[model samples]
Target: MDDLMKQLHAVLAVDKIDHNTVVKSVERNPYRRLLQEVLLERKDIIRSRMNLVALYETEEPSSEIEEILAQFENPTFPLEEINTEKEVEWQPLERKYLDGVSKIKEETTMKQTQLEKDLAKSLAHSEEVLKKHRDFRPVDDRDFSNVKQSITKHFEQAKTNLRGDAATKILVLRREIEQQGRKRRNFDKNTTDTLQNWFHDHRTNPYPSDQEKAELAKQCNIKISQVNNWFGNQRIRSKQQAIRMEEEEQKRLAALAAEESEAMQTALAAASTVATSSNLAAASLMTLPLVNPTMHAMVLPGMPQNLLAGTAGFLPQTNYFPTAGQMALADNGNGQPFYTDFENFGLATQPDSEQFNNYLG
Candidate 1:
């Protein structure tokens, strides 16, 4: 039936308690009761190394304890604020923690008041006695011990936050390093273009000096090794290309010369044929009168029609006839050596040797 109360785990000294006057603190602030469960001695956490700020900050806010958190968020009263040196037990609480889950009724009762008095006396004497004999701090004064512990804890927290920030920064730097590695392996676009332009510009002597290579690497944001490799490969490729082009050019010239030679041989053969045909035609024309004035052509009866007839369409040789026949044995179809009247088939006059030679020429 007393289950509405939620536990409070102290984040810092005075995170739970209100004042050094235990009677007033327990009576007025029932929810601010301190317990031993959160102390280093009671904690089961590893090494008992506590980080209170981290613990409290990470915990989900309890709607049941909204009133307590609100005061913690924005305090108005002195008691609403975290306990300071003014509180009798602030020193002991600053060094440790507080855990409590007492029912609201129990916290408000006289029994809780007596317990708070006893707790305030333990580890911390009566505040009146401290001020009278032990030189207790003034109400407005700060405890150097509390201040030192706070600075130390905050510095540690800041260190942890800074470490997280450092982790993120390292990841970004790692990505950039990877990007640079890729650029080194596969040359960047700007560097490629720059190198190509340089190569073409200095085609006569594409080599670069050490200083020039250094400048190129600086401008391209790349490594010297990459630049060196590019030039070496380009030179080799250019040489191979030049050799291939020369071979191709030679092949092209040889093909042209071969074509020209073949054409000349064809022309010479044509001219030879024409000259032979012209000489045969000339011989045929010279003998035509001896054969017959009216005849255009004569193919011998026993000869094949395939005789070289391309001499002015047909040729007649005067050697076919016999000379000096008076009374010819004239069998017309019996292989006869016949003689004809001077107007018809007659003895052929032999051409003069000098005239024949000159005519043939």
Candidate 2:
């Protein structure tokens, strides 16, 4: 990536000089031409975004380019021999060549900064839609799309700048975005593949067998408990979901059955409107408002079922099965008939005959 960027910058710088030749006399040129302007603008945006990285290149590389430009002033090496390290390294020639290169590099860097500022200002003034698109770009490329558009416009407006180093550098930025995107895709694919294989192996009876567990520990480079706990949690979550589904199904079925049974019972009750003694007594007992059935069922330990069955025959027709309130007040069973000494026990008084009849029915 770095090598490609250097090559790209070198191309842009060369084209910028050619562009300068077309538009202005070397003696009176006030500003750079199209390629120069574009390359300068790109450099500024890159400098700001990669400021930390730029410190090394901007300072060190500029110094080196300046040293090279100094050699141009004194012909320390013949023009044809400028590319050779041998003559260029000798005392007088070396210093001159170094200075010449340094100046050239500095001039190019300055040109880059100017172009960046121009691009940045244009983009900052552009439409909100363009601004939004720029914001979604990566940290390095946040200003790229807008910058590219501005460079294109500048070139069309200024013919001399049309075919220079700036165009080449812009292409470099695009290649950078592509390369980064490809790397990111590969990383995501690898992560997904690892996760998929892990889950596939664990899907059935997800709890790991001892051998599988050891292998997983080695593969993940983790403790056995970590793998064990993760599988345990996943299994528990799956079980809870299954149980909730089953409960929902059971409740649905029970609701359906209850609705049908209620309809049948409503019909049966209508047919038995003429209530009999047993029916009336049972209805009376059922109607009595009690706190809890377990307490009611405990009232007489070892109490014969036949006693409850026989109570219907003993109840007087006029009384409609003695009110439970009356029975409660009857006695506290210390050799007393429950009915005769009702006032002595701490119990409620009996209901009226009308309430007793309603309860019986």
Best by lDDT: 1
Residue pairs with backbone atoms closer than 3 Å in model 1 (clashes): 20-88
lDDT of 1 at 262: 62
Local distance difference test scores for all models: 0.43, 0.42
lDDT of 1 by residue, 1-361 (tens): 0221222123223333333443333234433223222223223221112454454464343343444433223422322153343455443332221111122223333443554455444324323322321121132223323333443444444444433433343334434433432322576689889999989999999999999999888988878888898899999999999999999999999999677556544544543442333232222222333343212123122222222122232223355244553333233334544432321322234223354333323
Candidate 2 TM-score to native:
0.21
**Which lDDT tens digits does candidate 2 get at residues 1-361?**
3453354346436434243332333224333353344434445544443433333343222343344334335433332333344433345534544454455445655776676676566556443333432222222253345345544445233322322333333334334433433322222454335434776676775656788778766766666776676567667877898899999999999998677456435433532432322132223322322212221223222323322222221121222233444443222225442221112111123334354344334
What does each candidate score in C-alpha RMSD?
28.6, 25.3
- Model 1's lDDT to the true fold? 0.43
Output the number of the TM-score-best candidate.
Answer: 1
Given candidate 1, what's the lDDT at residue 167? 37
Residue 184 lDDT in candidate 2 = 23
